[model samples]
Target: MAQLEQFTTPVDAVVSRMRALDAALPARDGVAVFNRVYLTVTEEVDRRVGTGGFPDPRTAITLDVLFAERYLTAVEADGPDRRPPACWRPLLQFRRHPGVRPLQFALAGINAHIGHDLALAVVDACRSLGCAPAELEDAYDRVGDLLVSLEERIREELMPGPDLLQIADPLTHLLGSWSLERARDAAWSAARALWALRGLPELTAEFTDRLDAAVGFAGRMLLTPLPD
Candidate 1:
């Protein structure tokens, strides 16, 4: 077997703790089970920042999305490649049931920044939580929906409003631009929010630190313009 040490995210520390959670889940097929675990995580930023969600924190939605994408990738340092195609596109789409959409979404979001391999680890973490990959999917969706709305609202209020695509082109669309201003604001807001979320007890320490560090790292990237 390949060594897991190659995986860079701090998630390794938390994976052990989540084992108990995984055991409680009922039997299910592997691929179906996997989808139940990763979707909808990326959508939180879309809901929260996309609409100019936050104010005091003053964040740029576009930038936050970028940061969020980076954070998702951190956990994937080395693992199986299971990233699903974008809702708009699909190299090979993973399908999850309606109840499991959130986890799958989150998984998709995380994989967006890194390789698909890390997604397997995410499933392992869910197992430790006493939830099947499916349950984690449900849990994450509910959590992402509620938190993202509030976070996005607060984030928009914190940062001045701007469009990100205007500044740089999208991977899929050359003509479309990503607004640099939005990227700066979103990255900053996400960093601060991550810093604050670090204090919460609901998440394991490993999960918190890995994501927190990722936010800071990505936020720093926002400082530099995307290389031409």
Candidate 2:
């Protein structure tokens, strides 16, 4: 496993850590389930970076790496028994529950990362680059586009078979209410809002807390355990 500081490229380091997690965790574990989905997205972003898909490669890498570090840091900081953030608690706490399907796990993780972590990551990137949110808009949109595209495929791959999934199932309604595209759009908006309000630490902190709580509420809903 590569330590966070070992790699010069932030994306490379994130990809390495995610891959290591995939290898170490059981396939059905909630974190592992999300890691697999996220790993694919990171790899694609890395490919795009190699192929010159972004206008600013350096800025793109910086945003992508810093964006990922937020999640990695949370995981690293929370030892096996420690509590994660409100946004992460549902997935982490109910990871091994038999009633929680893979789709739930995947979506819950996505909710936490995209809705909560991504916004903060944007602010983190802005501070690190000493640039405004508008400056990083291209990189943000490109990364978001990748996530939106993959969201469908992840649902299709992880959802229970049609025969097994009934329309009346609560999971159906819960999943329907959450959209990755919507979340991505909202995250971008929140990032811009945060950037705009950075000068007012109290306001920024309040907005961030509200976002975290909202995302956590969604995660808790997504993790609603179903009957066998």
| Residue 83 C-alpha lDDT in model 2 | 64
Provide the TM-score for each candidate, comma-separated.
0.24, 0.91
| Model 2 segments more than 4 A misplaced | 1-8, 80-82, 167-169
lDDT of 2 by residue, 1-228 (tens): 143223336677799999999999999898899889888888888788778787777778787888778777766666676766788878878889998989898889889999999888888888988998889888988988888888889877877776776633667777999998899889989998999998999999899989988999999999988887
Tell me the deviation in Å of residue 41 in model 1.
Answer: 14
